[model samples]
Target chain A: MAGELDVGYVAQLARMHLTADETELFQKQLGDVLHYAEKLNEVNVEGVEPAAHGLPIFNVFREDKAKDWFTPAQALSNAPRQANNLFIVTKVVE
Target chain B: MTKRELPALSIVEVQDMLRRREVSPVEVLESLEERINTVDDKIGAYLTRDLTAAVTEAKKTDVALPLGGIPIALKDLINVEGQQCTCGSKILGGYRAPYTANAIEKLRAHGAIPFGRMNMDEFAMGSSTENSSAQLTHNPWDLSRVPGGSSGGSAAAVAADIAFGALGTDTGGSIRQPAALSGVVGFKPSYGRVSRFGLVAFASSLDQIGPLTKTVHDSALLMNAIAGHDSRDSTSLDAPVPDYAKNLGRDLKDIRIRLPKEYMIDGVDSAVKTAVTAAVKQLESLGAEIVEVSLPHTEYAVSVYYILATAEASANLARFDGVRYGHRADNITNLFDHYARTREEGFGAEVKRRIILGTYVLSSGYYDAYYLRAQKVRELIRRDFAHAFEKVDALASPTAPTPAFKLGEKTADPLQMYLADIFTIAANLAGICGISLPCGFADSESGKKLPIGLQLLGKALDEARIFQIAHAYEQSTDWHKARPKTIAEGMKRAGKAGEL
Candidate 1:
């Protein structure tokens, strides 16, 4: 069951680097959790609709009018690296 | 009132005194400051305090307002302008909120002073505060045990009388479970009843902010202040908000309460069963009808919760990529490495495990098998509640299977810790409101009396009915008035020790 899923691939997808020990540990833990989750297979949910939310809410549109919003300074206040009121990130094309 | 009695005063008592000018807000703040200075070292309830600001705000408070001059502790997840909102994770180490949450804005408008920031499980992930990267909050009842989590600090603050009432967010029983363990009143309003704007999202679909207080009436008062529609939150319900405090002291006659047999199954502590069973009997004596009902999907609640909550969490937590806010990795060579390394270093073990699990479940091949199936099962769980409500007004169960376990007891096994919320998770899955309050005590092996909680679950948007039932039961019993022995002793010693 553990071999059915690649822990490293999932970690890569999650964008979380894992040590060798953590990878080994999570492989086993995730397998156990997945095994437990397999119990859902027994329940007859053949015709049941998947509920994304408890209450049904739809088309929650607001008027397309501009209003007060966070200033660039406030938005950039917590940025780890910022310059000229712009977020600094690793260059995508280098 | 004496200085020692100040900490024990409920919101109602404190509000009345403020209105009548019997006690100035400064005096109340001073008393609470002294109490927190003395007892908070032992409880670790607060992560940070803006005492100077709180004092300044108290002086300007309007005496006639609903919660005027009342200092309420805020769970760190809720934002307050210019204050640290760590959400119990090191990733947010230096992150200060630039604006206040909608709930905090409501609290401020009602004249409630948001004073101290409380501790919680990191990103609201674990069931114990031990997962908190900053500090460990101890149970006031027994220092050796946990003060439940992820709102552990919020519950501990109210239980130890450091705050009149505190705000806590419930995503998979975070608020109610801790309140149960800490022997305080915790209410999780129905989804959308309170605006989620500015709350640090854990699992967006399941998270709802609520109150933890010393009394059910205080919970209702807090709810009245926080519950309403907000255009800022698209999901916020447009339903008319009721004055929750108005329904209190009402008789519970003709209200049908259901006791689900599935909750009383094996693995529940005998003492917990005994206490909740006795509470049901007390409710029966209070003129409420008690009927045995079954939510057949109860056994699948925890499983379904983990899948849906973590799946949503994985998506919700993706914004913490180290550039916009939170900790950033140094010496990063690339963008992908930056994200991976920052998250790896920022999140704790339990958080990482959930993220990994979430990522896997939502992955392409496994989506239908795990995530989709869980959502469909979630609908079944919701339907079970709907069918039950057709016959009964509310459901009752033990909030947790047992009293507070010794710290570090379940930390090693994530699965075991997940089971601690067995009875409470169903309420979240069904998106109903639930409240946990003191019902009785279970004597530990050392003869120490640890508190047990009786949970009353209500249908979606029907908090008024549950409040009436909970208030009636609470008034009939003296459990809510029972304080932790250790806290009581600490207060006495503080009285002798003089003001800080």
Candidate 2:
């Protein structure tokens, strides 16, 4: 069964605001996609486990140590707006 | 070979010429410049190029190294230090990379020059390069047709003879589908076979960076350069990298190839089916045994992929909110409005659609019904491949259901476009390696020749086995030798056309 999607609510959750036209369009398109995905219900997944990854990757860890990486300037190079080596943004606590 | 024809030659051909001092890397860049200036106007394969720096690097390079001084175009998503890393989205309009990708680092270590930036579907979300916010890439075979995406620019550049070779990522069929449509050799190594340290994530578990080149041997050479472990990418395979070119020219005497019944669905174009069918017979003639196999859950692959890939994409792309690098919204209602409006203004429709659907699936109420269900089905899909692998050495199928479709043919219907990846999506789900190489040509209704690709899938980390089979077939067939006729015309326009 295709879940009923509230495009406006979903868009808000995704941190996006779709136009009226975009909402209607995506709603239909995503409806078809979700409907197609309903085919998953045909198979029995009762005893099956979800795949963790496409490959069987073993444990990968590194010792806690700092290595040479990009400097503050390099990291801030593409910042849309910067000040004192920090990224600028709209006020959140106002 | 004369300098006029230098850019059109394969990596091996150019490597030989450079090592013998017949032509310098500077000469190769010059020839490429001429070709690109002439052809790229119609092809639109490159988003950006840095030939001055390329020539500078080439002049100092040692042609004696394995990939010494050869130029390989990069899909825009792969970051190179100090270069613009636009993943074909307005969100990343002016962002430049702070560090190089591990793949690029390895390629540079092998003496390869990564110069040009190729276009792709915006964030590699679409099947046709039409989704690129930068420019639309056209098929070299027919200017009106599309080069498959999201590596369309990479494929078109190679097909147009403007790029010697290119590196492209395949999450779903970004590399192979485009390679098929453009008539080149594209290989998607096993998941984690190549490190993805600097690759912008789409679906982290599904994405693998690979090569799109003129021949099977060229792809092998590229794999030797880029495949290995990296602690930076925890998922990268810690396995030994093999000489991918070492098994070429070997006979397929004992190799067993399986023809999956599910791949030849009713929706497949008759021409593509005929081409793949003939390719199977050709392999048999080469002394390989052919067997029929069934991937029972193959039908569920695309559905699983869309759900899981989009879910991962939603989470992966969450970092694009207007806080750091990339486009920041000027609209200042509040903190939330900044992120919402910035993404709305920055991302394209298809991207937003995926993000919405992705967020919805992983949303509180729909998690088990969509995301988890898809993963469980994904496990079944993986088991189907595992079961088939127990009996056959490799599986064969059509790389794409059909050759290149016309521009805007399926854009209005996103589902139709998603179905285009039907044949190639399963490999990514199963975590197997696959290669698409030219097998035959299908004449379009207007009588233009379109290349068809035959895909061969091998078990995890079995790139060598698949390469051997593909190389043997490539050597046996003349299909790989045919280049798009527009190449010569483009070269002529550049005043660089001449016989070798």
Tens digits of per-residue lDDT for model 1 on B161-192? 89999999999999999999999999999999
**DockQ of each candidate's interface versus the true one?**
0.82, 0.83
TM-score of 2: 0.98
The top-ranked prediction according to DockQ is 2
Worst 10-residue lDDT window, candidate 2 chain B: B491-500
iRMSD, all candidates: 0.9, 0.9
Total clashes for model 2: 0
- At residue B63, candidate 1 shows an lDDT of 71
C-alpha positional error of residue A8 in candidate 1 after TM-score superposition, expressed in Å? 1.6
Interface RMSD of 2: 0.9
Candidate 1 C-alpha lDDT tens digits along A1-94: 3347688888899999999988888788777777777788889999899998876766588889999888999999999999999999987798
For all candidates in order, the CA lDDT equals 0.90, 0.90
Candidate 2 reaches a DockQ of 0.83
lDDT at position B467, candidate 1 = 90
